[model samples]
Target chain A: MPQIFRRSANSYARLSLLGALLLAGGLIGLIMAIGSSSYVTRANEFIEQPIQFSHLHHVGDDGIDCRYCHTSVESSPFAGIPPTKTCMNCHSQIWATAPFLEPVRSSFRDDRPLRWIRVHDLPDFVYFNHSIHVKKGMGCETCHGRIDEMPLVLQQNSLQMQWCLECHRAPEQFVRPRSEVFTMGYRPAVPQSVLGPQLVKEYGIQSLTSCSTCHR
Target chain B: MRPNQNSQFRNSQLPRGLGRWSFGRWECAAILLCVLAAGCRQDMHDAPRYDPLEASPFFRDGRSARSLVTNTVARGGLREDDHLYQGKVDGQLTDTFPMPVTAELLARGRERFNVFCAPCHGRTGQGNGMVVQRGFRAPPSYHEQRLRNAPAGYFFDVMTNGFGAMSDYAAQVPVADRWAISAYIRALQLSQRATVDDVPVDRRPELDQAPEVRLPPGRPETPPAPEAR
Candidate 1:
């Protein structure tokens, strides 16, 4: 009991309590940061595909429309991946003998599908319909980013629940005219502030945030 | 050790009085937080269901989407309307359209054509499209007398079954859209050959002011009018 604790121990004890609280908060914050970061979310990451198809070449230079290959985007829940025949539609003649396109050719000749990697895969619980979004004036570029500039396509946005809620909460901030839904690099002729609300009203877009809106 | 077994062993080793003890509020809270953190596994993120085009381990082809068996027609897929599905009447290509041609249909056709056909056929059906410029075989110009004289069903048949170097677009273009594109092709044939006399009396004056420069096919100068929708 003879001076077992120094007088300075009081301040040390106080500092240790504060440090413990700070360490807990820092741990929680770090977990949250990791949860939303590109490492977990896979945003802005280019996935390797069966073929190194260039969106920049097809969309930007050749000016092929998105609907050309994603034929079911306007009518189905899933935007259809183009069958190998779609690739051979041009590659059969344009790059007929190019060794790089042998996979595309073999897939066509053998009638087997090319195992193209999916980029924007959402969690199994989420149900996204391309047609409804397209109908409601959601541009492909809005979520996919500048796909025409992507040599190899990448997931343009964090396909996280909170990220989806950003648009679902205020669709007016993002919607364009339905006609411009497929147009890449779309710029609002009127300022978005003026045009977004009008288009939202016109398209009858609801800010559906209920769990069932996506979960079901 | 398994968590339950470890806890059971610890409980057996505890003194009799301490064995009946409960955790403090902080200990309980910490345990609850640990349990909650542990619940963040990817079980829900990757539930046992195939997403569209997901690979399947069971199928030899590794496709979750199975191909339709030969001659297996889906419900409501009989497609008995030869005029619509095959572009035929009495086994001959018919010139008449199954649906009435409207301004709306033309607009839809123009949009779909640009998306599905304009790469090879060109925006004006001139056959010198971007793909042709890129060294794909140049298709016959729609303005050609041969194509102009061809029946509407002939164009639809060509799109449905394909001809010469071109492949069939039946998989990509729906039946209704093929007809619409056929109508639009007829319109293009007319456009290239039309003289001043073809312009309506009321619109003739507007034509004289300035020949409006056509933008690229997909980029319409104006959003479709409300009535168009």
Candidate 2:
């Protein structure tokens, strides 16, 4: 017998081939979308920490400086997380028995550390130093956003490689007076375009784009 | 033919009459492979390593962090100057500063004191810091006759060794910074007790006018209580 399905056979195969190619392309697109989604990138995601520490209440209303808790920001690579002792220094008197601060109390009592979940986490390969940035006149708000406004801390920036590279290429655009580095609501006295280069020269800031600056 | 054999032959071939399972084995496998590939990840986050302070079987002491070798100073950390490092000269607290008391030193001192000492000793050294307001014990005011007469070395010693109820600031503050803070305390004392004659004639006119700039951590310019009565 002659091939029963002559013309339609190859047409069906071609359609199937087209469908397979489309499916592969769609899968790749989906993967890319997922990788950059809020679920994966965690931008604007509020991580549940051990204690409900409100930057709004403490830094905003109470007018506490960021340096009070993150004491090592000026001197070390890590903006040192406040230990139980720092909390107890104040909490030992105020709100010493509040239900909300139970974890802080227990951590202090047992001399154990509260396992705060990492927010703004980059991959292990990438390195970031808070001290160098702060010393170079970048405000806490520049990278951390308006932390004073957040009741629950969230990852404000995407913290992606491109986001980092944008600032690294022209650090003058972000540089402030060294005095204003800790001021959350600081505004440049002059326009950023005028002030940035001036401050960069004054501070002798070098714009670095080397891979080892962060990736090593 | 046996029923099993008949069913097996039909299953191997494509549907003679169109029904749901028309795809071949290779087609089914391709679908499965796509599903599996979508779920694939490298598992980098779960890579084997010891976390900080983690217990380890490899170590006899069961600590991942090894203790530093005995009696060692870190590189470039040899603190040598008697006055700069110990706030002392000739094994006694010296009244004089090792470095010159410059205008820049006072500026730096003001910044450091505000961050470190002003929490307890108030911005103006009035012994009424925010911590004191919140119930921490108030320290002696710098303007007090006793503290006013205190040599710069006295303040440095108190900061380095700590006074009653105050813990040593040796960890929080560097040795040179302690001297800066002491010098700032002297300036604060002078400010509280300054005579009108202390203002230089050329610059005195600016003092009469309300301060245009907010001076850091000192007396706020009070508008001369508009012609009292």
CAPRI quality band, candidate 2: incorrect
In angstroms, what RMSD does candidate 2 have relative to the true structure? 8.5
TM-score (chain B) for candidate 1 is 0.77
Q: Give interface RMSD, every candidate, in order.
A: 3.1, 5.7
Q: Which stretches of candidate 2 lie over 4 Å from their true place?
A: A1-29, A91-111, A204-207, B1-82, B89-93, B213-229
Which number leads on TM-score?
Answer: 1
Lowest-sum lDDT 10-residue window in model 2 chain A: A183-192
Q: Write the per-residue lDDT of candidate 1 for residues B40-157, one digit (tens) a residue.
A: 7888889998998888999998899998999999899898999988878999999999999999889989988999989988999999889999999999999988888888999999
TM-score of 1: 0.88
Q: Report the Cα lDDT for residue B146, model 2.
A: 88
Per-residue lDDT of model 1, residues A115-211, tens digit only: 8888888888889999999999999999999999999999978888888999999998899988888888776766678898998888889999999
Q: Candidate 1 i-RMS (Å)? A: 3.1
Candidate 1: list runs displaced more than 4 Å: A1-4, B1-40, B211-229
